[model samples]
Structures are given as C-alpha cells and as structure tokens.
Target: MDCEKQTTEYKSLLKIRTGDKGFKDLSVTCVALANAQGGRIFIGYDDKKKAPLPEQHVTPDEVNEAVTKLRSLCFNVGLVASEICTDDTGSQYFIVSVSPSMHSVATTSDGRIYIRVADKCEPVRSEDLQRLGEEKGAYQWELVRTKYLLDGVALDALRQLANDIRKSSRVRQHVKQMDDVELAENYHLVDEGYLTNLGVLWLGTAKQRSSICYPATVQYIVYDVLERKVRKEEWHDNRLNPKELLLDIEQKAVELTYSYEFPNGLFRKQIRHYHPKLVRELLVNALAHKSYTISSDIMIKVFSDRLEISNPGGLPLGITKDNILHAKHRRNPNMIELLSALEMMEGEGSGYDLIYELNAMEAKNPPMIESSYNEVTVIQNAEIIDTELLPLLDFVLQNYQLTQKAFTAFGIIAREKKVFSTRLSAILQLQEEDRLRSYTDKLLKDNIIGRNGAKKGTQFFVNPQLIKNAKVNLKTTLKTVEPYVLRTLIMEDLRAHPKSKISEIGGRLPEIDLQELRKMIYSMVDVELITEGARTDRRYALK
Candidate 1:
C-alpha cells in the first residue's frame, strides 16, 4: 500500500521469510504500533516489492514461529487475530494484527519503548512516553474501585439518580426497569461489589466525595471586563452528580446574565448574556472529557464580555482544536454513555457542533478554542453582533438542514454584514477553496446567501428576500477583530496598530522572544499573508 502517511490509524508491515534478520526482533515494531494505534504484520510478503515472496512456499513453521516470538517479545500488546490469505496465484501470507493497548503502553522485550508517527515507528522517551501512558490511563481509572463499596453510596443520591434516569426519556425502557444495583452496575458506576471512581463521584456522600481516589476540583469564577476575579464558587463537594453540576452552573450563569430583548412576529424574544443550553452542553462536556488523573479543577471563568470554560487536560490522543469541530473521541466513554442515557448529551459527541450552531443562530462570535499540554479552554465571546437577524436565523433553523460548518459560514456573513470569500475561507480555517463548497453550496443553491463579484472581490451575504421579510435593516459593521496572534496571538496587534515593526509587536507580547518573533514575522511574510515596509525599518501589516 502507499505509505506516505498511515492509511488509517492502523498500518501493515511485511516480512518475507521467518529466517530473515528482519524477523528476529520484529516485536519492537509490533509493540510500538500497539503503543500508538495498532497495525498488522504480513508474513511471507516483501516490504520493498509490495508482494508475496516468489520462493516462499506455504509455511506453518513461520506462522507458529511468528506467533511464539511475538508472544514472548511484546507485553501489554494483544495479538488480536491472525489469518492466512492467498493471492490470485495462491501465494500465501500470514497476517498478525496487534490491537492498541487499552490502559497502558506497550514495550519491547529489552524495555525499549517506541510509538508510531506516520509510516515510521520512532522511540518515545521520558515525558513523551509518560504522556502516552496518561493518554491511555483514563480507561483504567474510570472503572477502578475506589476506597468505597456499593454500601458506601449515599442512599438519597442513589434514589435521586434512579429517579433521574427513570424520568429521562432518552434512557431505554429496559434500562429504566433495572433495580438500583442493576442500574448502577449497568452504568458502570458500581463494579465487582464496590463503588467505582465514577460511582463514588456520582453517588457517594459529600464527605466520601471530598475524599475520593483522586483530588479533583470544579470552580466557577466570575471576572469583570478587566479580567479581575470578582466572585468564586467551588464544587469539590460532589454532592451533586455530573448532571446536577451542569444545571447548577447553567442556572448561576443565567442569574448573573444580562439580556437583549426584542419583538419577533407576535412574541418578544430574549437573548441572554450566555446561552443556558450552551453552558450546560459545555459544562457536561467538561465533566465528561476532563482527565481525572490531572489534579486540576474544571474551571468556568465568566468574564463581563466572554466565558472561558477550561478543563484540566489537553485533548485526547488524536483530537486537536482544528478537527475538534467534527472529530469525536471520548477520553471517558463511561461518562459519555451514562450521560447519554440521562439525555445530558448535546448530540452524539457533537457538543462543539451544537456550540457553533447556537452561537451562529445568536449572531455571536464563533467559540474561540485554546488547547495545550496542560489544559483545554473554550472562550465564548458574549457580544451579539446582529439582533435584527434573529428572526431570519429562526426561519433558517426551522427551514434548512445545515452542517456545522455551513451554519458557521452563514453566521460569519450574516454577522460581518459582508465578507470576501477568500477571507471567509481563511477565517473558517479551511486550506482549500474546493472543500468550502460543501459549506456554502447549499446556501448559494437555496438563495439563502448571494455571491457577488468574483475572485478576491467576491462577497457573500444573506438573501435579500429573507432580509426584507425579517426587515432586518442590517447595519454595515466592520468585521469582528480576532485576537489571534501568529498561529494564535498578534492578529489583534496588527489590526489595532497597522504596519507595526517587530519591536512594536514585541512590546505587546513580551513573553515571545524578539529573535523568534522576527523569524516568525518573516516566515508569515514568506507565505505572503503579511506585507513588510522598508528593509532598513521593517514594519508589518496583514496582507
């Protein structure tokens, strides 16, 4: 197969003959692949020729040897299955598939650890390996029994949970029919006659929760426009389960909220400072995805103008912010499954999509996401750009089926008043104009949005008919300034102070070194995204 990048998260390697030197210590590659995603090994096949060996005949010895060697060599890596397949000419190859390690890292016989990166297997050492192990660790911790047993579960809380599940329409009839222990066991809250880590967090007494297997915290901090902390609340008590925490946090946000009210048809519409649904969805996700191993709080920092909901861990193994809008990977599947049973999910791992959809409908700024090795934070700006378009948005939501990206693109044009196609593409983080068709084609086809001019001059806007129907009278507002600089910082600086030199930008972001900043400036300029002034005195601005 073509091997520039892995075709899937999996890969396949070839071994022509068992006696070949390549066969002696093959478990290194096997273990590495298991530690990462997982791959298959094809015996009696040649990696160089991409075909079965010409001279190699049917060999039961090779299959047995390969199996025995792999069993003896790799630990914590499962040889999931094996099969022998034949080509058109009846040439046989033995396939040995290694499954990804669930809760730990796999290592070679000699204690050497390696991880797959693309088509190659590379050694991972020290902190990188530690991070790898932690990536796989949530599965183990979620089901592990804490110091508590089923009897330790608070009776009131257990009764409360049973009632909640029974009340939830999302839960199945059979699931709702289960007794208390059966319900807890079915949800993985109770295991092997004991309260699991999740069970303790969900049903344990306040005192039991405050003293669980892990020292965890949940904080809701309020801030003014200046970013100074005004008020704070902590929820390590865990008296409330995940669902209860979601409601309490959402309610508090509503209590502190300011709102914009207007007429829509016969009824008055009210848009709060924070969307309560979005708040619950974001918080529910934070509760589900947070790394329990990381001894940090799931923090909701509410600013006068925005909200930053931060959880302890970065994204899971294969998730990044760019793909987070569509890619779904759950660090804690048990939490997700249980939450789904209670109808606490926004959609099937589509919370980000819902966040985007809700923001778009409200004409609010698209949620800004920040992720790093230690934390993942979602920043939702509270300002509404267009109040008049709410009626139009309501019409669209009621009428059309838009993908997450389509709604976001529509929102951008509607909020910005007018947006150039290329610039819109960039803001959407799309690298190819062709891919953008999927988001805008329907809008263009339905005449929901009109495209004018061509190429760089092309502008997209909401349909005149719809705007007229709603009597939107949209104001011609400047584009919302993104505070992104370089990869994520500096855009605000350039927008606020056009044609700024490195020194000027440096003054604003003192944390980044001047030389490194200079290099980055030139690199961005090389892509023709930024323009530079005189060589003797370089000043830069967005191109």
Candidate 2:
C-alpha cells in the first residue's frame, strides 16, 4: 500500500507513529481507537518528522509479535495487521487497522479502558462504561432490581405507562402481546420474575418513585450580571414525560432570558423580541443530551452579557468537541427518539446550525459550546445583537396603534407582563415617538412597518414578513428622550390632523416638547417617510 498517501487520507481518523523499535505498548492506542470510532495505526515510518518519510527497515517477525500482543491485551475485541511491505525505493511500512467491536473492549488482564477525544487519550469513566455496556447488551440498569420498592405501591401509573408504551410502534410491534409482567421481564425489570428498581422508577407512583429513586428533576437559575445574584429561578420534578419536560423547561428558559417589546417605524410588521426557533432548538439539545446519571440538572444561566445552557453530560462516545457538528451520538437515545417523534426536534440536525445562523444574521458572535467532566455547556452572547432587536423594534414602532394586549399576543411582550400595566407602560415608553405621521409614514416607506385594518380602525404592527427582506443597519449611539410624552404627542397629532406636513405639524406642538419632536422627526427621516432641506423649512410627506 502507498503508506504516505494512506496516511494523508486517514490523518483525521487515526494517529500514526513510525520508525520506532518494534511495536511497544500499542494496547493503549488500540483501546483509545476502539472507545472512539475505529481508526488505523501505521508503523515503520518516522512520524516525528515534519514530513514523515517512510523508514527503510522492518522485521516481519516483530510485526507478527506486536499484532499478537495487541490482540491478547484487548479481550472481546479484534484487530488486523498487515505484513511488512517495501515501497518502490525500498522504504518499509506496516499497516494495522483497528475496527469497532460489537462489544466494548478493554484490557483483558487489568480491565482498564481509554478513549481518544480530540488529541488526548483519557480514561473512560464508570458511567460511560456502563452506557457502553448497556449499548452492547452486556448489562442494563433496568435489569438491576432494588429491594426498596414497597409491595403496595400504586399500580395506576404503571398501567398508564404500559398503555402509552403499547401505543408506540417500537413497543407495539415488539411487545404488544406481552402483558405487564411479561413486558417487565423482557425489559429486565424483573428479578427472578419480581419487579426491580427499574420497574419502580418507570412505572411506580410518583411518591413511591420519590422514595425509591430521586425523580428526574431540573432546576434553572438566571443570574443578573449587574446584581451579581440570581434574578429568577425555577425547579421541576418528574411531573411530565421527558419530551414534555424539555418543552416546559425551554419555555421557562426563554422567559427568563428575554424581555419583549414591539417597536414602531422600524419594521413593516410585528416581530418577536428574540428568535423563538433558535432558542427552542438550543434548549432541546441541552435536555436531550444531558446526562441524568450525573446528579446535577440542566441549567440555563442568563446574565446581561450572555445566556448559558449547561447540561449534565459531556460529549458521548465517538463524539468530541471538534467533530461535534458532524458526529451523531445520543446519550439519551430514548428521550431523543421520543422528542423526535413528537416533532419537537428538527429532522435536519440543524439545531446547532440554527444557533450559528441566528447569531450571524444578528451580527452577533456564534454561540459557543464547551464540554467539562460533568457538564456540556452552550453559551449564546446576546450583548452585541443588532438585527434581532431591529426587526422587533421596527414592528412595534410602525404598529404603534395596537393595544398592549394585542402586542403581547404578537409576541412583542411576555404574556404575564402583558397583564401588568406597569410593564405595558414600560413597553410603550420604550417604543414612543413624537412625530406620528412622519414616523408611521417613514416606517411604511421603508417596508419595516405595515398597516393593518383601515382608517381609524387601521392598526400598525412589526411586519414579520418584511423582517426577512429588510437590510439591518442598527444605530450604535443610544438616543435619550422622554418616550411617554413623545408617544402622547404622536397620538395627539394623529387624532387631530390624521395627515399633516412637518412644519405644519411642528407649528401645532408645544415648544418645551420640541427636543422629543425633533428626535422623532429625525427617526422618521431615517426611515425615509419625509424629505428634508438644509434648513428648518424641511418638509415631510408620505412616501
């Protein structure tokens, strides 16, 4: 074989070491490759060289001995080695390709196991080992029986669970005829035909399971960077199924992370304060991949600077931080499948991609994913977002006629906050402008705001459709104004003239409110509703 050519092709998948003495301690490399996806090992070349030229010497006997030793070291696993070969110029090389075993392989004598992740080889933890064993059918936690289950435990929940499982295609086709006892036996929920800890946890009463094993619970805390303390928190136990739990938790997470408002004069229609699809996907991945074996629950930490989602589990076997975008390995396979079936999870594997795209579209840095021993975290920095806020604010500004209740339904405000007039008042103040005709006209001309209804019945909202089409150019400087007074002035102008010129409009307004009026007029100018001259005689007109 062309060793140099092969090495280039498989560089990312395998590690190559060559020109050393006969294969010494290749067992660790073998184990590491096995724990990960299988990869090839090439010998008889000087790999340490910047350009690894092939070595010119090799012994067939030594190669055979090395292969034998490696095979003997890894029980329940096998590897193949090729005979020593020479290139056209008498350069020597030997190739060994390790394949993934049906069974998880470990050192036969010492029982030590290692896995390669990125460039480092690390010991596989017991929990990971257990997961491997379960995947290989060597052992299952569901099979282990706990003596703590009480005899009189409620069977109602168990019956309901059985019904639900029976309805599923996998269980229906494979386990419909099997009764509760028989089904329990097949899943290894029974020990000598008796119910075990797995049965108690899966089918026992809520209170009973609480006594037997802690119910899967999740706690979320949001910290305010300014306050340096938790601003909000929520905790939930095993009330809903895993899929429902994920949805519920994610919704609550969005609530903690975002503040909503519908701004006017910026967009053609109303828009949400944040991208719902991106937020939902991130949280779903967190809940799906999190390690329940680790005692800590998934956490969503929101600060003024960033939003972080920390899941309990790190990368699963065969997955690393580098290849995470391409690799597919589900630590919670059942949960993943169930959520997928429920249509909560996207089919295209676009969760991470969506997060990245949203960040890019908003001109924010891409979200970051990090893995630790006990947790995997995804952090999305919202501090620098531009496009995200522009569309929503534009929508609110254009559709200033809509009531707070209607705006809230359009997703410009939180549902709970909508009920509070204080919050609504805050939203209005944040979105207000002094020049009604100019602001609305400019928003409509720019296609950032669109009109709904007709005449007095006409209302404005952020144009959801227009957001996708609008080129975002967010202003950096924060302009200060008394927004409530400006909003009142705009409403008064609209109620009075219904249509008016800038100078005519300016003549009717109070001098003390001129700053706010001028600011609103400038905003209208930016949106292109009116034309301006070099002097105060600048006029406004509908585009």
Top candidate by lDDT: 1
- Native-to-model Cα distance after best TM-score fit, residue 225 in candidate 1, in Å: 3.2
Candidates' TM-scores?
A: 0.63, 0.49
Q: In model 2, how many backbone clashes occur?
A: 26
Please report, in order, the local distance difference test score of every candidate based on alpha carbons.
Answer: 0.72, 0.53
Q: What is the per-residue lDDT of model 1 for residues 211-232, given as tens digits with 9 covering 90 to 100?
A: 7645356888887778888888
Model 2 vs. true fold: TM: 0.49
lDDT of 2 by residue, 1-543 (tens): 343321121221112233222222466667766655555676655544412254456567766766777677676556787777676667666777876554555553468877655545567887677655644446544445666442454245445555665776554465767776665565554566455655655555555445543345666666665747665655554555454566677666654446434444664433333467777787778766765555676777767667788877556655545456445665655455545544667544656645544443343555677764457788776644444554544444465564322333233221111112222233233222332343245545655445543443344544545445444443322122244655556556745664455557767763423443665766765353456454555665433
